[model samples]
Target: MHSILPLLGATSLAGASVLQQALINPTNQVLFGSYDSKPLVSSEALEAQITEKNLRKRAEDLFSIAQEGVEEYNHPTRLTLCHTGHLATINYIYATIAELDDYYEISNQTFDAVVGNVFEYRLVLGDRQPDSVLAMSLTPPTPDKEAVFGPLVLVANDGCNESDFPATIKGAIALIKRGVCGFGDKSALAGKAGAIAAVVYNNENGSVSGTLGTPSKYHVASFGISNEDAQPLIKKLEAGDVIPSSAYMDAIVQKTGTTNIMAQTKGGDQENCVMLGGHSDSVAEGPGINDDGTGSLTLLEVATHLADYKVNNCVRFAWWAGEEEGLLGSDYYVSQLSKEENLKIRLFMDYDMMASPNYAYQVYNATDAANPVGSEELRNLYTNYYEAHGQNWTYIPFDGRSDYDAFIKNGIPGGGIATGAEGVKSENEVAMFGGKAGEWYDHCYHQLCDDLDNLAYDAWVMNTKLVAHSVATYAVSFKGFPKRTDVKMNDVSEPSIYHGPKLIM
Candidate 1:
């Protein structure tokens, strides 16, 4: 009996004997002896060979949170209205939210409450200040626009380069803009520039987020403006328009109102762990049973089922709170992993809206897509399962927009499942699946009606099975499955060569 060191805590004793029996019975001398020499490996060693040691125990804990609806990854909460971001239900991308109130022209009294900014109230060109305040005439239009006002003021230092300020003071505001770096960097720089209330704007325009997506890291109220709006302000600068034009950026916007329910599974070495996650929250208008509930619940059920499976690897089953808000929960988690924790991640498997009338097993960065870091082995395991079960799948590249974004950027392999959402069904898909053409795979995508009624139970079950197999397969599979880093479709899980019904893209 050859001895093998155990890594993932599980051994081949469970079902390994069956494969061994089939191999050594010697009943079919010709077929059984493919191995010329005697097989010296023990069944326990075989089992141990399949177990993965990189998983965390929080899988069960996080899953329970989702099952109880306590950890809504996409909904607003006390922490973020919906853990979408540290901002409010809505926030400025690279800037801060704008606010104002309307008043009766004759009464000269504040009438309407505040709305959004140019970052939030960009839509409102008309003044909404209190009629009383507007009618007062600002004491003959105050000779200096730079006069420090007690109520709403856009304050800043004379220079734009220095970021040296002390926190000893409070109340005064700070003025900032894009350029010297990112939105978050601007906030820190401005804070150092000495101003409690911080207001920032874009340095240039076009699509401010660079083709990749928005950058992570935020500290204070940030605002984003279009080139049209920003350029005009800059033009004013060229013409010495340094006087405060408006006070929209002067208001306060808070995402601290949102809540992020984080459930984790402790492991031997949680410093770095694999994250299997899905969004647990829903859109404000919908219950969201399929757009993501399918994925969330699938992961939840798998975690629950595997609760007692003493995995050697730290396996963390997570439910994000701000997915609908553009992967906020996941992004937060990734950002917070310690440098050591970041390195421990084996891979990140994400399940978002994984069930639909028709399911196609897709991989991130498959055909011509791009992602930060992906696993070929895991990708192969998924595609291989479909092929093994007599299913065909397509490999495609996907923007790392899901919770797995931070992980991938930090060099963690990322992949996920998505039956379909927010897109029209292609003719091939419609013809293959027999669903109505010109319709979205998920008719209830983000609507209030996206409850269990809109779900296809069969599809949900299939996705669950796939996820189950994926998690189980990883927990106990030989070769430790495969990783899907590059778009090597044929490298690990090559399209099945078996003759079977063709699967349409």
Candidate 2:
């Protein structure tokens, strides 16, 4: 039998055959292969090899590493790594989020309630808020204008048509129920009816503010109220009560900032690197635990464990900022890189939300028409992993909706997996994933309720394992994949910009 001294560092016959069997197995080939002279290494030799540590072990260790990251912020209860210069998420870039742009006060924004007039009113400012609140008296515009408001007129139904406005609505505020038509249409219709201002109460339970599509002469300052507050007023109005309320709005916009965290291995081959990351910031409402805490921590843990092993390629980890502000951080980083620098990256994998309470195993559908080449293999990596382990999985379209958007846009191959977000669970998904049907995969999405309790540990661990698997797999080899230098950057479109409220960090 082959000597066990070199493999195990001590000759012990008890496990020699098992070690010998492992050595002969080609599948167990280690990365460095310093101990692989005789075709394959023994189990003892392979165990001694860096590759034998396994992805699951590394993934499990992420819990503590993530905890360390969270604790670094001095928040023992929850980790909100927003707007910090934390190294855990920092990469090659050293600037903060606001520094990404120099013109027009890039990240500055400020808004406070308009003093006495601010009686819990939710105003819809479509993508533009004034730098300072300029109080304007509420009044109905003239006939040549869109709407009139003075004697408030209650629309007969959801304000979709001109007929909903009666003759009595002239020079009066139009009180309309929300339904049937878009908010802009209702506001414009009310404006046409000679209403001074449009008050659209939500059909649902929350306050609403939205766009009016495009600017029109008829457009008036529109507002929204929650159903709870509107119901009592609706009753009084039907009983012939005239409710007169006036409020002033003062909006302040300032240029402020946050940051993205990036960390890369100093040991691996810098010429060929693999990158992965998720957003580091959270919405202002609450600490985003499952949204990306899972993703960020996964990378940190992988990076931590990887420190002990040697690899053929470099691994860079990033925690993006302003992702909720429209993937601005990642976009800026990629834009700053030269064509030569961009080509240094072989691939990027984005991990956003990976632990929805009602989780569904979702692999990116790289086969979709929009995908760049080599995405199919990335998708196959995730799908194949889940399937091999007898786990159910599904596909989410590669719609340029995450941090991966910038990487793919510049022609780097990319793929990833997410448990899910605000998407509602289907009855079929309920059957497959064993969670409540008709509920959101993340019920607390973007809300203050998204705390540590929001995570499903089983799902979190599973997805992190997959992340480790991807990292280890790619770190070991890239034989079948195209090199970054060989592929020209595609003229890809930017990810669909979300003009809605910022819901991520």
Candidate 3:
């Protein structure tokens, strides 16, 4: 029988650890069994029970259930936000967590929203599979048809014209595209061109449901399209089916969303606290399963395990909202914290997208800087844990993207690990990690498919490993904040709360 071999080998020979005792006496297997009551702790089951691999499987399963119960689709035909779909996604997440046997316990549900920057328009090209976003951003100068009849032709719209189109007439409405400036530019140009109406296409991937720039003076009606739908129209104009009269083009830039959920452990090291956080919110439009229902669920699962752990330092768990809103929630919380309060804080640990579908694990502490006197030490701790586990790794920078940004900004040692997201998974990555090459690190990163049906079991195994490695490493290493001036960086001074005490029951 195997338990977590005595994590501590103290000076006294008589001070045999409970874990060591259990490991030495095979008969203890009967007392400390698994969730299923199996006497023999199979190496595979150990991987699933107390290891990172097991945690990730549980996390992904919850994500799958949330995905199925939510509406992740983005439709150009229908544009909305903070609506039924958004609430549905929240409901799904709550329901999934509620159903998990006991690994997750409901803590609290606080809801709020950020000022979303962009509008998401989904245009389904069932038969008209437009190659680019420009192709599908079709528009007419007016709402009415030609005197007798006419096929829809894209109207040109120069900024000078009220409409960006050549002319806003009876049959033809103004056909405007998002370009050269604000949505107002296309609309203003279309209005000057005499367009009765218009449609624009966004050059980006996510959403732009909200207005860009500001209040508009333009009179013509308009909407934006994604790049996937806009490219075909470019071809049509080149082929003479439509004319690119008054054209506009530029990448659509706007706000997405994020959520930050935080709560202190009922018990633990309070004076020297270790903070665990990950963004629960994604690209507003996505289920954000890997981007990161995985991280969020991992923390929630760990939270359930906390009530069983008693120790020295206070542990605080927070799920950040508005991470997509440029780390807003965390920033606000940190900003509002009394300076003295900030200093009581110990290390900050973040787990973001740890289970990449492609699963190429490249982690970072503090990105290079001449002053490199920051989160680098914290980074070493996490990576060191992996090394102790006989794992190899790479490190990247702590690019203030997630909720930890607020902590780092206030001079806190912020460290985090990520599997991969949105970035391309290289051919070399496939060679090393063995997932499909050339695919985005998270195929479902901000897509509606970031649900249970899309995750790989092995990927789940990998995600949980990193998360558990980070959490467990931080847990036993709870000597309080490392001596701020102590040069023994990455050195484990004391055991974390998880190693404190255990109830055989």
Candidate 4:
């Protein structure tokens, strides 16, 4: 095992910085300066110390964080970091000796919240005997309790202009094809006309589903249908068939509170911070133990352990909220940063769902052409580590599927690790990882069953050690990463836009 005792007395630290000097000097030592001359200094030793028992204890500590909310709210709701949810997680983080604790918000956000939609629709074709048909899909925030019944009018692609909705659209249900602009814009334009509800069929095949970007003044009850299902109606409308349909929406739109817990080290180079995070909130379905609790606690445990170790670069740890609601907290955090602060973040690492019971070691495909510079190196870090341990690994795209979405949107180099979420295991994955094939990575994903028992301790310990490895490596040096001086200043001027495929739990 690698030992750290000899490094403490090395004379090479004579000219080092404050933290380096403290770490290297034997006389001016703090907690870890000299621990019985047999400290667990090496990465392997540290990893060894993070036993399953320790993880259970730390997880229990995290449960206490949620327990506080349960006591007050009479039920644990670590659902989102918004409102009281944010306060509880923040309190827990502050209980640690973090240097920075703050909530971040996007400048000039119009709605306090564009709450997620909860609506249902029933389709009825217009004829002497109209038949009841079901919509293949429905978008949220549909007009709750209100129903819109009328003949369907087709609006072609890029349904943003009023002209797209023909004069017949007045008091009718607008049938718009999805393309060009967002689903919200099409619905808004239809609402601008006299259309009571808007239904956007998919531009391609299969079921249609997407957010309206956000709530709008002109937004009406909106839902989606498959191209195949909508073609008959489109053809009938083309043949002048007055197909009448009824659309209704029931949704709750209100401002809910949440917070992002950002903790920066006070003793490191503030100009070149190494940032890492995982979403702090859970889905409303369950406690979200493996979904993100494992990911969040990985960083939290690492942060607590590093309290005594000095670092060259400021390491910022964030426990984001509203991730399940969309990448809300991370997007807001990126939005509020100044240009200088944005540039200071040399790299961002995201961790979510680190312990899927039926797991596959998947690293983000940072080597993809779309990723910012230095991403490939991040990929290599994890790949090399796993390979060194004789473990097989796979790659997932660096798409905007997680909290890393916001960072990458602004051209910040980002990478992360995940044990799968709803994805089913393949035979190859089964052979490599020894998990059952054709089963979800996490059987209880986003379900009420995602409790403490859902975790796979073996996977959790291994993945969390990887988190520690990355933190320790970057804390000591940015060897495999681009330095602050070499960073390309990408314009992150675009205001925060949280739009994309839903990040399934």
lDDT of 4 by residue, 295-390 (tens): 887886677566545666678888877777677778888877777788888889999988888989999987636666777788899999999988
lDDT of each: 0.41, 0.57, 0.47, 0.66
Q: Highest lDDT, which number?
A: 4
Clashes of 4: 11
Worst 10 residues of 4 by lDDT: 1-10
lDDT ranking from best candidate downward: 4, 2, 3, 1
Among all candidates shown, the one with the greatest TM-score? 4
The CA lDDT at 441 in model 2 is 89
TM-score of each: 0.49, 0.59, 0.57, 0.78
RMSD, each candidate, Å?
A: 18.3, 14.0, 13.8, 9.7
| Residue lDDT tens for model 1, 101-138 | 10000100111111111112111111222211110000
lDDT of 3 by residue, 378-444 (tens): 6766667566766556655444446665565555677777777766777877776677887887777
Output the better candidate (2/4) by TM-score: 4
lDDT of 4 at 64: 52
Better of 1 and 4 by TM-score: 4
Give candidate 1 regions above 4 Å deviation: 1-253, 257-273, 357-361, 366-374, 477-505
In model 2, which runs have C-alpha deviations exceeding 4 angstroms?
A: 1-120, 123-252, 486-488, 494-505
